[model samples]
Target: MGWHYTPYGLPYIVSGLVALPVAVAIWKRRSMPGALPLSIFMFAMVEWSLGNALEMFRTDLAGKTFWASVEWIGTVIIPVAWLAVAIQFSGRDEWLSRRNVALLLVVPATILVLMWTNDLHGLMRHNVRLDTSGPFSVITKDYGPAFWAYVVYAYTLLFIGSTMMMRSLFGRSRLYSGQAVMFAIGVVVPWVSNALYISGNSPVPRLDITPIAFTVSGLATSIGLLRYRLMDIVPIAWATVAGGMRSGVIVVDSQDRVVDVNPAAARITGWSAALAVGQPVVEMLRPWPAAADACREHEIAANGKGARQSEVVQEVAGGDRSGDRSYEFRFSPLLTARGRVVGRLVVIDDITERKRVRDQLVTQQRALAAMEERERLARDLHDSLGQVLGFLNVQAQAAREQLSRGKTSLADGYLETIVTVAQDAYEEVRENIRTMKGVLPADWRFAPTLERLARRFERSYGIQTDLAIPDEIRDGVLGRAAEVQVLRIIQEAMTNARRHGGARHIQVSFAVAAEGVEVVVKDDGSGFEIKGLGGGNGRVREQDGVRADAGFGLGIMRERAEQVGGRLEVRSAPGMGTQVRVRVPLRESEEKAQGRDAHEDSGR
Candidate 1:
């Protein structure tokens, strides 16, 4: 059985056949990612086939010279091919320099030259008897020292290359470590067989199982490549796109089983996350019955093996895990490589906030339209109706003078009274129109606009009204809304004092506070029952902490307070003064003013 390479031939043949399919697959793939290893595996399988076939007919080769040429060529090419494969497979091509190729060629060329020259140099070969114990007398030649020398060079090249390959492959943790181990075994086993034969311990035949095993290694690595789609598989890429989408996704099979659910899908569905593997997507998603119709239509389109979509916005009812949430949904059909319909993929997004804002804006638009209509009516009444009433009051006073004599003058006084009543009626009409005109810019920044108001109150009303307000308000914290509220509060207090309390003194003060700005209006007036007062004329009155008023004046002030996250306080008692105080949170500059006040108070 010694020197019989027959059994080893089977592995080479099997591995070679396997490699054919794998190479075809790789070629079809179109990207030769690592060209050298793949090419080496391919060529090595072919080289092994040729070498094994030649070794099987070694003895008969001499009788047929052409056959002998083939054997000789196989022997020579096997070493070179093995070397090339090992160099490439182990990634030692960088070291396979031009100098190394030239050096390698020298010995083979020398062996050829010596064979042509009749072995005179005596290094290339020396023959030995092949069989001593057989009657057939097949005189097989033994290998010469040069042949052993070639063996050493071949083995050294392979060993070094394989070792480097192992180191490199093992360094990569993510790659096929098992394939690397198999290749190492493939390399080592045949070397052990060769060693045993060289040591004369076993008479068994030594054919290089390494090439067969190397082919097996190639097949294993290729299978790993195909299965894992190690670089990038099309299906995996598409699956990733489906999984990583921003909108909620749900896929259901024909049997209505859930197949997949993405991250966004989890948030919108409002159900304790259902695995998409085997649940009805409609049942799990809680889609309306109408959605099935849209899905059916889309599925019918998909029967043609083309993409189809159904864009539907549906407000799904709340599930057990989530409260209320709105969603915009889209359903599409999944497709396969051969353009076959797979299943439905449902895409959805949570649009609750968008709907909420849209509703608010619609309400605001309606309110704005009503306000514009009211403003137009107020302007009409002020320009037309108020002027006519003023002219009527003037004409009544003139007629009262003409209707007078000495005793008739008493009747004229009554006519004068009628004139006065007419004037009062006209003024009240004007006042109503003014109030209906809404809060004005002058009233809003009353600090700057109050000069004439103060003068008029002092001259005509005969009440000393003092105004102490800064010309340039530093902190714009006292915005127009806040300022209007403060001004109205002061005006109301002043009016109450003049008409009911007969107040002769008034003072208005505006000052920066530690936490906010403060406005105070105090008047020396006969204060009425604070509790007895209704939210008088729909104006603000305090009960507990909240104000009781439906009038726009107090409502505006309260709204301004709430807007700035501030507060208002009113203190009044009968037969004493009344104080109305407003506190508006200071911005940075006013806060600095507050800090200075605190420092001054501390120093004092």
Candidate 2:
């Protein structure tokens, strides 16, 4: 069981065998994004192969020459491996702009020149010596200057690469950072130990310790790589995602000290992430009096509640002056593997747009209530006033008839004139009431309402209107609100056809699908300049900003349709009649049928 015993080879041999299959599996699976780690693994396998070869050659002449060649050939491999690992780990490969690509190509060439000339000769040995009683059958010079440069170059790449890797891995599942650290130590420690041995530093009695250390580092790294997926998964990397979001996120221990904050958290909270790392979470976030104090106390009191607590919307003052920012502070406990809560996660999302939408909804609701009131008053006057006028006309007619039947000498001129005036006034009032009712129909079913509207237009404006609607739509488009919006939009289009487009005929067609809605309205009438009309998305306003009579109808239809998350489309031709089509989404259950149809279509 001594270091030189064959049993000592057990670990290296086992690790090498195990690593080969795992590396192959990883290569075959190809789940990871970068190709460099696979390259590093290839290098490791080569080194392992050489080590095994050297061991076998210990008692043979040809084996000795092979080992000598193997030992000196690092001139080509080490620098290449270092450069590859550095580029991959730095995450600069993906962003290799022209400028960076030039650097990438050049840096290695410089390193190679230094290696061959022994200028960077500090890292690789120019000579080898034979010795007895050492771990190998031989030993080499300390080669201080050469060794120092070698150590410096290798370690500098490692240290810089690892720091960047850890930063990229942070806040990911603890598995990520932990694995990265493990891999880094696994590689660096052994390499450093070997350097120390080369310098004649006494620790393990012989250079044979390099293999043992290498075996340990390899085992540790292999374990971590398998467990965490290391460079194997295609993702933004937890550290990169957490660092790049616009919201503030904080992780706090039970003691309330801040354990983590991303760059976004720092920018929003006005605290440098590095400086805020160990400060109290509450102090860093510092919500107003009640919220800040409550967070600390409640977090401790709740202990391990699996609930996510949220705050009432609060205005965050002082930042960009776009408007007041309202934040919804969400608090969820961070739990350990065993389900015990270790800490809490705080996420602050800017809900300013949500607040603005809510305010707009309130204003619209008030306007709707006022419109309803006006409609109610208009209806009341129409019904009551029309009946009163009819009764008065009947009475005047009766009086006039009675006076005519009586003697002509008894007829009063003033009475006759009064009767005539009252009859004319009653007729005018009746006509006004009819006009006030406008043109809405009593029935509102889809097909029936459409038929009624078309007939009314034919009779009133002497225009032929044709509506082509299928009996049953494969995709259902008629939610209550959507139905109303569709009807109103049609009504408006018909009005426009008569008043503006001067259409002779109209056709409306609708097609609906599970994913979305489509409506086409085509009209042949006196078409105006379409460009001058502005796109449909623009607000239709009156000359005085009160909304044009035509514009009002369009606005109401658009608003109602948008409320139900549907859309309205209007199409017209200059002299041709207009056709309008309306379509809306079917529910998820219907999507299955639609998908089947789609699949069948694709098959065909």
Candidate 3:
């Protein structure tokens, strides 16, 4: 409010230059937490420094006191601004409501009112005089109760604000530690300097050097702004999100040291998230192998490009149920603007429920397939055997009546017809029994079982069957249900070759390929013409619901494959040999589905 020319104003000018630019820098990023408050604090410093410089250089007593009062505008408000900065920076902004801010303003407003009207009460300045103190005109003031009260209020606010910033500096991420240090120096310099001056311990008598201290504060905070981008954000933001997340999150530096861990991660590793930080994640999770691998950032850090994957089961505590929740840990490179890998961020998602629901769905599908299979078999019997049995009953009754009328030849003929019908029904029943093979392979891991099946077939039917299943393909592609379906498809193909194709040598070979798990069943037997069968292009499509009346029809075999989620292909010619190739795509590991398959097949 008051200005005077003075040589001591150079320090104030320098302080203004420093504080103003820092203020603008922070103001530009005012949307960030603590930025606006920091800007306000910087502005207050500019006002106080410039006003004090003017007050100290002025020789006239009235002008000295008036300009000193002008300095109150910055002095009264500095603490409030600092407190606001601390509150917002420390993630405690919810306490800073409109009412609280209005209340905070009241103290500074009252202090300003008292300072301007001090001439009436003499309570603010008690006694004031302009004196030549160390070659500079300084305003010397006798102590007043109001001025002491203001000192206590200002220091109290400073203490509270400093505590907030220090708490985060010590407890939060180390990345922002430098910024915190600079910020503390900036705030503390003015506090100590003012306390000394107000306590009558200033280096120069009758001169308040508090404004000069703002120069140092401004310089310290300016360094923080330029070097650390202070007030833009704090490392606590990362920890805040990581801490509150339901999914486990673990962050590691480039050196693979654990930098941050969420509570969920601690729950998984059985180590405290707070204490585990700054330790090696590998060391912390050594007791649990699966979880250790999940938290390990070494490989991802080495890769530098990040990783892409689906899901994997990471057991927490329990067996394969609750305590043993599934987690899909995704590893990504934490990069800067220049694409530098500073660290790796691992996001652990709990997928236990997803796996459980998927297993339940598969189980339901299998149940539905079983029910459909039963219905189809029942319908076949009703349509053929049921009618045959009914006809036999009628012929038997007719034969009995013919015999009762003394027509022995007619009764004998009816009996013969009954015998003929019974024989036809017997053949149809045999055919049905021959076509149905037990529900493929029961287990998802079917290499051993398939080998056993081949051996059994060779022994029973006098056919030389060789199984050439590779190791990788055995436990690779397709889920449990699909594997069972694929096995059934191959089983039916083998049966068709023996009964219809009259195959001599049957070879079952499978290999893991890029496309998927490829299975081939080749028979050097009397292969039938695929074109002549309804499977060829000329015939009605299976989608059209046209039933092929032929030997060993593939309608049911194709349906079973589709039901279990697989693709089936039957390639054959007149005598070139038949190749039943099945390519089942790979499925992401679903432990729940695999376990359910095992449970269902335990009886088999």
TM-score of each: 0.32, 0.51, 0.53
lDDT of 3 by residue, 39-93 (tens): 8888888888877767656668888788789989998888898798778756666
Model 1, position 561, has a per-residue lDDT of 61
Q: After superposition, how far is residue 480 of candidate 1 from its true place, in Å?
A: 27
TM-score, candidate 3, is 0.53
Query: Root-mean-square deviation of each candidate, in angstroms?
Result: 21.4, 12.2, 14.0
Off by over 4 Å in 3: 1-6, 171-176, 204-206, 218-226, 229-258, 262-604
User: In model 1, what are the clashing residue pairs, if there are any?
Assistant: 130-140, 258-276, 258-279, 259-276
* Model 3 C-alpha lDDT versus the unseen true structure: 0.68
On TM-score, the candidate that comes out on top is 3
**Highest lDDT, which number?**
3
Q: What digit string (tens of lDDT, one per residue) describes model 1 on residues 553-603?
A: 333445556565567665677678667677776556545776999999787
The Cα local distance difference test for each model comes to: 0.53, 0.54, 0.68
- lDDT of candidate 1 at residue 603, scale 0 to 100: 71
